[model samples]
Target: MQYFIQRHPLNYDGSQLQSLFTYKNFGLMGDSVLVFRGSCTVEQNEMVDMEDVVAQDWIHSEDMLHFIVEHFDMDLEKTIVRQRLLIATIKEELEVRGVTTLRRSGDDLYAGDKKLSVSIATLSPVSTLVHCGLNISNHNTPIPTIGLTNLNIDDVFQFGESVAEHYCAEVLSMRLARCKVRGVS
Candidate 1:
């Protein structure tokens, strides 16, 4: 899957967006200023929950592994190992940074008090993806509508962008190392 992160206005109303804005000022506008859009292809498989409860059609990561090995010519075992290590490191960093309320259950990380959930998975053998969502309800209007909210859109975009840059650097380093070993440019 491919994704994009872009800037928007703090207010949903189109009129609030200024004709000229710097990235720093745009970030100051916060969550309402960023949007993340993506599409993914999911393969389904059955899995048992923590309580041994069976669940159907869970998103399978094997397809992603196959795609990555086929397209990127990376070793599947090495990629999976790196992904596991990266996720564990991220969780530890979050805790060390004082995000003590969040807990990891399998691949899903949750912040119960904040009504936030973040899921991390290997999108491709060599690539990992992070998804974040918030639970919210709008009560000011007569019509009642409830949905998962995006109160930290900017934060999410920044995190994703950082991950992408890091992954690209790692891939480039691997290619360079291989070339050096083979006496190639």
Candidate 2:
């Protein structure tokens, strides 16, 4: 597992949830989690979640901190697990930084009634992809939103790095546990 923070601001239009996004965009080979600052506008054509499309939910945000994870294994269930794990890691990081009133509802995060993040997981032909975006500014969103800046978190990149680091560690820990265990007769 590898992680890097993208310095440039890349707008996420839901098209980046493809395999090799990290490798093609940032040159990080193998399984990787990339964090960046971006604007999110996922039109219906680019959406992978059918529920959102059926509900006509508009996924948009003015400014966000985005995390894109790509793993070679092709398992949607495992990818969803990783998606939730990433969300939990973000909540843990926020709590560690002394921020309160944060809640995890499935793959999304909330600060009170206002939403703090959005996420989804799906499988490509070659990899499992996850996109998790944390709101940086509450403007230009379809729903009531709360951002990191609202909670006094100014170092967005650092926050992203911390979340990615912890997430990678947790994934590695799980892999280690699986490999080190002996099979019982």
In TM-score terms, which candidate is top?
A: 2
- Where is model 2 more than 4 Å wrong at Cα? none
Q: TM-score of model 2 relative to the true fold?
A: 0.97
Candidate 1 Cα errors over 4 Å, as ranges:
1-54, 59-71, 85-100, 103-153, 170-185
lDDT of 1 by residue, 13-87 (tens): 111122112123434221111233222223222121222224333221110101011112235455455444434
> What is candidate 2's lDDT per residue for 1-185, written digit by digit as tens?
99989989999999888999899878999999999998999999999999999999879998999999999998889889999999989998999999979989999988789999989999899999999999999987899999999989999999999999999999999999999989999
Clashes of 2: 0
Cα error, residue 50 of model 2, in Å, equals: 0.8
Report lDDT (Cα) of residue 114, candidate 2.
99
